[model samples]
Target: MPLTDTDRGAMLSVIGASSVDDLFVDVPEAARLSGPIAGLPNHASELAVERHMTALARKNTVAGEVPFFLGCGAYRHHVPASVDHMIQRGEFLTAYTPYQPEIAQGTLQMLFEFQTQVARLLGTDVANASMYDGSTACWEAIGMARRITKRGKAILSSGLHPHYVSVAKTMAKYTGDALATSAPTLTAETDIDALIAAIDGDTSCVVVQYPDILGRIADLTPLADACHANKALLIAVVTEPVALGAIRSPGEMDADIVVGEGQSLGVGLQFGGPYVGLFGCKDKYVRQMPGRLCGETVDADGKRGFVLTLSTREQHIRREKATSNICTNSGLCALAFSIHMTLLGEKGLRDLAGLNHALAVQAAERLAQVPGVSLVNDAFFNEFTVTLPVEARPVVRTLAERGVLAGVSLGRLYPGEDALANGLVIAATETTTAEDIETLATALQEVLA
Candidate 1:
């Protein structure tokens, strides 16, 4: 049933083309690949392909296999087996966006619960279903602020994760918004006064990371007050949602918008993502929020039900009037997050957070004993920064060779910044053990020696 060359020639003639290459006339020659991609085996059997892929997979040193400490944004936390089992149920696993509320009650109800959980956890009045991930949610918060405040400027805190900052800057470039970012702070604390000074009349929002990239926890009340005085919105970013269980909610500090990564909850790192973005804001600003919102209702018989409350994306509205170009929610990942949170009720979450902090303290005390290492943060939640005597990147490599998965190197995040080259960001979840801490400390001592 395949078309022959003569048939192809006739089709090309009908389209007024001489050859297959003519169809690509709009593509510049320099941008085109010269030939087939290198290193691709030709027509391998299924068995051979499986073998090759397995061999490639073996090269990765998984977190569970080693004494792992690496946490910059993504983390390694224990996901209960029940979460996986519940999410994999046929009803939830293959479900898509609940565009038709009548037939999609189950999906809509789950999203409603997800929104409720995120709203309560963040202490905000309302939360959308979910966004792509934490970084995109951060970018959308900036845009929403601009809409609400009618301003063009945003101030990014120095302690914000570099990856999140980059995503915001990229979005700003096309939207023509001004992003004034502070220089990276390598110390245990953020320069709050500098952030306050940066806010002015044209500022739309001030973005600060709670339990920021370096793992230092900051009370955003003063910063939030400063932003409100300038008629600017305060956007509090949380990279680790689990921290919310122990710390004061951003809403309590009067933040106008709260955005964060939900990866640490039910979601696994999965080699950087397929993660969920948690977005919540004040009730007054709900109309301007990006993504979808689900709400509970009563049916004809007065039975409870759920429906899509608001969908402001272009697909559901006039393209010119849409609140966001983001089309859909991360439905499955959000389901996983909600199920996990349900398993760990308020008390369970707090207990888990406390255990994480206790483990982190043990790791910090052990690491501080190493001759060439110094602890950076005076106060931290489940993670802390350490200053090593030598560049941390090479030391991390050496540790890996010694069969230990050490923490993330600051130099890896902020490349070419000499001041941060010796900084290391380490984390300890409930999964971290005393033996793991000892392994890291021993390996670090030997490496530095």
Candidate 2:
């Protein structure tokens, strides 16, 4: 049922447009290209293109080949083989959004379990099906906070990921809201007292990342209380949700909204894409929340069924009055997340989190023994920043050449930032073995020498 030329022509004709180019009449002529792109070949056979791309892909070294330690949002957590096996069981993988809940019983059930797990993990009352990714979830949280408080100002902490902050800024620009951001690139050990000072009456939400970029976990209960006193909402952004197993939930800290990336559950870091965005909030703000929510109901047969409740807030019915244009979301990814979480359950997840933290502590201890290196945060969960004698960029490149993935360099993420330029953020998951830690340490020592 692929689109045919006749169908395309008919659709264009129905719109009173002669060609596809006619639909772009409003586009600026300067922006419209006069010709095809120069460097690319005109066309190639399917097999030939596949072979070409395969050759190109083989040139790059994957994470599995090297002792991997890279983590700046995406970590190399060990997902059980069962997680993917269950997700690809045909019934779940092939299912779409539960638009018709009666027919989509499997998907609706998965969504129900996913929502429950997210709510429990975040210590929130309600969670939606899912969003695009962590960044978009943060964006939507700000919007939700604004709607609930009837305020337009947002206060973002410096410890938040720079990319997440940028996304929030872009969303603010579109809505014409006021945004006050702290200094960029703060580690987990950074001063939260300064961030609290930035909150004011007009501030609708105060956003902060848990176990922040430097892997320093913040006890945000005090900050949440301060936000509440100022009549501002607390939007907690968690780039790594697995950290929740060890740390306290944001909702327990009085967070009005808890949004995070759920890729660590079952989603692979497929080159920084296709991650599930976890979103949950206080029950009182469910109406203002974005994304679809599946609820349980009884049918005529007295059997439990799922239905799409509270969808009128979407763009289809309300048009410009819609709470959000995110009518659809990452269905399969969220299902994968739900399946993985179910397989782990509560105790299993807690054990996994403990392993990650223990491995990270071991890695930090070994790396600290190296000369000219200092561990920045003594208190951390699974990741932490290391201050090196020299800039970390060249050091990391040297290690990569030696068949070590190493960790993320602060200089690379924040180009001109001097304080962090010499630091490296390292992570250790259940997948990081002692051999990998040793390899990283040996290579780091060689590079520094």
Candidate 3:
């Protein structure tokens, strides 16, 4: 398949170019490479390339093979085989963006159902098809709130995931908005009073995480009320969507917007992504929501059908007027999420959430028994923070070497913060078992001792 000098010359002639160098005449001569790049290997056979890639992949420590407990955003959950099989159907797998309503009914209908399911789960009036992921969705929610309130300031709760806060800050810098963030507390509890006090007339939205990064669940109703009194919007973030099954939804808590990572539902960690984002909001703000919205309607024959009702991305409208510049939705991942949710009905979801909580409680009890360990939160879902006698990062590394993937170290996320040096965030999902918990407990104890 490699092109010969004759083939290259023929192609250049067809394109009316004397040489390949002519194609890049616009690029600065100094910027262009003088010759073939150094240190790169020459071409190899297919078998040799495959062997090299397989060897590299083998070096990774996959979550399924270890006593894994890693979770800040991505989580390890049991995805039903049916989800994969269903999404792989030739039609569903190959379907692109459903821009044509008449020809893309099947894709549109699936999206409609996905949106309905997300709306119900988040307790919002309407939900978009999907977003890039939870972090980007949160950033978009802030933009939507700014559009609604016509404000310039966004107040972020310290308990929100640090990664999410970083993303918002990055977006705000380019958009010429103001972001006021609080410092994380020692006890890992959200400083609700401070967040309320930070609100001012110029505040557009207050973002807080439910079962926050430390896994402490906050009652957002009071915060929502305070934001409303100040003419600011309350945006609730849920990193673990399964917690919605066992706790109050953001809508029930009067939050104006709810955004979250749906990876726990049907997606695997995949070492980080290819995850789905869930975005929903109050009925009145549906028009400002980003991404596509699928709606049900009657055709000329009086038969029911689905169509892309609201597409507020730049591709569908004027660039300045579009709600977001996101070009498309995560259709395949959304299909996987919808299928997994359908398999786990209300009762099944509740049972799964309960199981995750029970496992976490058991792990917490065991970890607390360690000589110098203390639980950080009294109220939490399936994950929580623990304070250790020494810095947590080294302890976690030691445990990993001992064949137990303990958990995330807070110091890694908020480096150079003295208060968080000894803090560790641990998660126990339904996939965690008695044996795995015991293994983690024993390994952690040994490392700390």
Query: TM-score winner among the candidates?
Result: 3
Task: Give the clashing pairs for model 1.
Answer: none
Model 2 accuracy (lDDT, Cα) = 0.86
| lDDT score of residue 266 within candidate 1 | 94
Query: What is model 2's C-alpha RMSD?
Result: 3.0
Taken over the whole model, the C-alpha lDDT of each candidate is 0.91, 0.86, 0.89
Off by over 4 Å in 1: 1-19, 30-35
The full ranking of all candidates by TM-score, starting with the best, is: 3, 1, 2
Clashing pairs in 2: none
The TM-score measured for candidate 2 stands at 0.92
Per lDDT, the best of the predicted structures is: 1
For residues 1-449, write the lDDT of model 1, one tens digit per residue. Answer: 39999999999999999998888889999987777678875578899989999999999998898999989888899999999899987666733677777778878888888999999999899999999999999999999999999999999999889999999999999898999885566776676778998889999999999998899888889999999999999999999999998999999899999999999999998999889999999999999999889888999999998888789989899998888999876788899999999999999999999999999999999999999899999799899999999999999998998889899999999998999999999999999999999999988998899
After TM-score superposition, the amount by which residue 224's alpha carbon in candidate 3 deviates from its true location, in angstroms, is 0.4
Question: Which consecutive 10 residues in model 2 have the weakest lDDT in total?
Answer: 182-191
Per-residue lDDT tens digits for candidate 2, residues 263-367, read 999888889988899999999999888888888889999998877776645554767667888867888889888988888889999999999999999999999
Is candidate 1 or 2 superior in lDDT?
A: 1
Collision pairs in model 3: none
TM-scores of the candidates are 0.95, 0.92, 0.96
Error of 1 at 366 (Å): 0.7
